[model samples]
Target: MKHTISALVKNRPGVLAESSTAFHNNSINITSISCGETENMEVSRMVICAEGSDEDIAKVTKDLQAMDFVIKLDDLARKEFVDRELVLIKVDVNKDSMSQIMQIFEVFRADVVGMGQKTITVELSGDQERVEGLIKILHPFGIKSMCRTGMIALKRGDE
Candidate 1:
């Protein structure tokens, strides 16, 4: 099963590396990861996806908390949450086809974040399935390139 863990770690050099190295040593494959500094002191929020059982996740969380840099560890599986990922797609465009593609973008509420002579980059942020649905909708149009952020989530309700 895929497990999502949210970790609060001290924003110090090599902390992330050490934590990831531990997972690597355990033969756990990290499918997605996102990290960013939060406002409270030098702390970072890390979201990691790995294939592990409940017992394995428990062990991982326990091991991580032993590290000095770790502040708190949360297993998102136990919470009600909302998650999203941002996607940027650059699509091939021509003068005649640009207007048609723009209409499609309007339908999906995608924003044109960047534009080049022959391409337009659209940004979409939503649930995983909705994001992929937009991608499928745009597939009829040629895509030059695409980029996606790993999933980020926040638990619902007051903590």
Candidate 2:
């Protein structure tokens, strides 16, 4: 199962390493992790997506909460939340394919962030499904490369 957990931890070196130890101890494989500055400069919100059993995930969350650096931990699976991922896809483009690729980008609401002699790099940020859909559609155009920022999430409503 997929477990989405968030931790507001001190913005300091080795914090990420320590927090990840909890998951490692539980034998959970983190599928994706995104960490960035929060409104408070002293802290950063780290969203981690891991694959593990419900029982293991529960234990991992407990272990994380016990850590000193962790100011807060939110188990997103327990509440309504929003999650998004950002991806940059570079696809082969030519006179014959440029127009079609542009149309595909328009349909997916993707932005063309870069253009090379034979490739165009497009950027999209959305839910996993939306991002996957765009990638599937763009495959026909011959993907040259891509980079994705894994899932980042926040719980809904006032905490």
Candidate 3:
């Protein structure tokens, strides 16, 4: 099963390394991870995605919560949450293909952030599925390069 775990920890050195080690020791494979400081600069929030059996994920979560730096842990996979990912793609473009590419971008609601002699760079921020779908559509245009951010999520409504 895929799990999205969020951890609130002290903003200090070694917190990320320690938490990652804990997940590693528990044999959890981290598919994605993103961290940033919260409004309180002393605390940071980490969002991690892993694929593993329920028991294994539970064990890893338990271990993380036991750490002194860890202030909270939430298994977001089991809750209603809002998540997004950012993707940047550079696609080959020409006079003949420019209109088509623009149409594709419009369909996906993406933005053309840069233009070069033979390529146009598009930026998109959305859920994983939408981002992946846009990539699929852009593939035929000859993708020169692409990069994606790790998924970041927060619980929906009042938690």
Candidate 4:
């Protein structure tokens, strides 16, 4: 199973490295991770997505919460939260396929961020399902390149 976890840590230079090392030490199998400063620049939120058994996830969560640098920790996978990821994909294009691709772009609400004669780049942001749907649909267009950001999440309602 996949789990989403977040840790709030002091926005210091070594926080990220140390956090990741802790995961490594615990043998936590991470799938995606992202860290960035919150509105208050003094703190950073690290969002980690990992695959593990229930017991393993519990251990990881407990271990992460006990870290000195971590101010707070939450297992978002079991919380009422929403998450999104951003993807940029460049696909082969030509006059004959332009309209079809454009239609798909509209259907997916993807933006044309960059364009070339032979290829066109698009930006799409959504939850994993929506993002993966777009990529799967665009596969026939011949994906030239792609970039994706790790999932970021916020809980719903007031805490």
- Provide the overall lDDT of each model, using Cα atoms, as 2-decimal numbers: 0.87, 0.91, 0.93, 0.90
Model 4, span 1-159: residue lDDT tens: 898988889888888777777777777888999888898889899899988888878877787778788998988877888899999999999999999999999999999999998999999999999999999999998999999888999998986
Candidate 3 per-residue lDDT over residues 16-133, each given as its tens digit? 9999999899888999899998989999999999989999998998888889999988898778999999999999999999999999999999999999999999999999899999
Q: In model 3, what lDDT does residue 149 have?
A: 80
Best by TM-score: 4
Question: How many Å off is the CA of 29 in candidate 2?
Answer: 1.0
Location of the lowest summed lDDT over 10 successive residues in candidate 2: 150-159
Clash count (model 3, backbone only) = 0
Per-residue error (Å), model 1, residue 144: 1.9
Model 2 CA deviation exceeding 4 Å by range: none
Give the lDDT ranking, best first.
Answer: 3, 2, 4, 1
lDDT of 2 by residue, 36-153 (tens): 9999999999999899999999898888888888998888888888889999999999999888899999999999999999999999999999999999998988999999998988
Of 1 and 4, the candidate ahead on lDDT is 4
Residue 92 in candidate 2, Cα distance off native in Å: 1.2
TM-score of each: 0.86, 0.94, 0.93, 0.95
Query: Residue-pair clashes per candidate, as listed?
Result: 0, 0, 0, 0
